[model samples]
Target: MDTRSLVQYELFGLWLLKRMALRFRCFAKDERCRGSSVIGLVCSWIETDLEGYRFGDNLIVGSMLDDLAPDTEDHQSRYTSSALDAVNAASIMLDFLKTRDVSLIKEIADLARDSVDMLAQEMISDDLTEAALENAIENHPLMVEELSLQEYLWSLAGEVAGSGDFFGDLIRANAEVEARLMK
Candidate 1:
């Protein structure tokens, strides 16, 4: 791929990842109303809004990979490596949510820190470094400004962790909407 294409691809990937992370954070805070339909709607919005954006096609790399030459082991390996890194970052975040331990969250933050420690880290170039990522993870600016909003909602609902209900509602709402759209 040419340099322009590579740049486009990276930008698109970053956009998608950032969207996913934001949605995840929102779901974490508002578990009570989360459902597949809600999540689907949010995702649909992302796709639609980003459709004609500069790096939109870069978001299609996973689909394109399978069509690449099967014998191109090096190419496949590099793709796999990058994919794994993304997966690892996401996994660490998920684990932190599941545990809800401040220490664990801090640790996960550290992983992100480590990932972006290098001057050449894409997070740095993309302006999505660990500090920004942690801020996004802990507090989704688009959703609400105060952590108290989440805490209050959870308290009213008499729940701890504030994750299960919110994310469950979002996933279910998203699925419902997707199903209807497909019909």
Candidate 2:
């Protein structure tokens, strides 16, 4: 894809991941009101199930539209299925990230290599630096705010081994999955 499309893809992916992460954190803080929001309910459901064996993205998204919506209005107007799928992917990513193994990123990167560039793929596999970590921290609020600078930096570096394509690959993978679901 061209640079503009690539940038938009990356930006959207980052935003979705951050939003999902924030939602998960919010649910973790209080798991009581599952009916409060569709995203919150989905997060709760996913967290309680097996890591990767639980509900499929399509299933969860369908449920979100059919059952989880807090109201009866046209919910599709407020959310896209693709975006919901990304949220599901981000939740899975959060689960994987809990392991603190950056090598795990390779599996995700490999899955979406076609959508990402070699340079970003290489970065995803490289070591994480304070600069990069700071950038992530700035871009992602509650997601990493709980970690000390060093902890956050090492977490992503050690998890992804410093390569830079981690998030990019994730975004691409999300798009790929959404496309497949569309078909």
Candidate 3:
């Protein structure tokens, strides 16, 4: 699959996890509020760490978009597609939250989980970025075979740093995810 496709998959997975984390922190973790005590450490991870990954993605892509010449708009467009996809996903979350429909959030998580599962089946290519994305999905927060949606939210949010520098953001997210996995 192309890098953009992989990014989309990752974003969807990330979105679901983020949504879950936000929900768990607000509702799922509190039994008195009808939440489960089983929400656990994963909730902490999401709140403390994994949130704002998409903002990091936007920072990198926005920087890239700014660097391109007006004539190279098409090239810039290719790079921006994934970022746009991420924005759309976030809007979906915002819409859900505006109504405060907790149960509906499950649908997003399910979609995110499904996206991760679909991505795990994708074949990796010689491209380094694609390889990195694939590796990211196959491991850490994702662990596609049996993805823990809750943990994924925290891991990605904590790990993903939406920086203005592209490579810098990638490096940061990788290092953060690596450290989180080690624990």
Q: Which candidate is the best by lDDT?
A: 3
What is the C-alpha local distance difference test score of each model? 0.34, 0.37, 0.40
| lDDT per residue as tens, model 2, 44-89 | 4433432234444444544544443223143322122223333454
Q: After the best TM-score superposition of candidate 3, give how far the Cα of residue 19 lies from its true spot, in angstroms.
A: 9.3
The residue-by-residue lDDT of candidate 3 on 1-183, one tens digit each, is: 443333333433444544333433332223222222222222232233323432222333333323321232343232222222223334334433234344444555555454444434443443558668666666744444336644554345433433345356655665554454444
Model 3, residue 149: displacement in angstroms?
4.6
Better of 1 and 2 by TM-score: 1
Q: Write candidate 1's Cα lDDT for 1-183 as tens digits.
A: 343332232222222333333433333344332222333333343344323332223223333322321232333232233332333433433332233333433343333333233212323235678787555544443223223432332233222123355445434533543453233
Query: What lDDT does candidate 2 reach at residue 8?
Result: 34
Steric clash pairs (candidate 3): 46-154, 49-157, 49-158, 50-157, 50-158, 51-157, 56-162
Q: Could you tell me the lDDT of residue 127 within candidate 1?
A: 62
Cα shift from native, residue 163, model 1 (Å): 18
> What ranges in model 3 sit over 4 Å off?
1-85, 124-146, 149-183
The residue-level lDDT of candidate 1 at 38 comes to 32
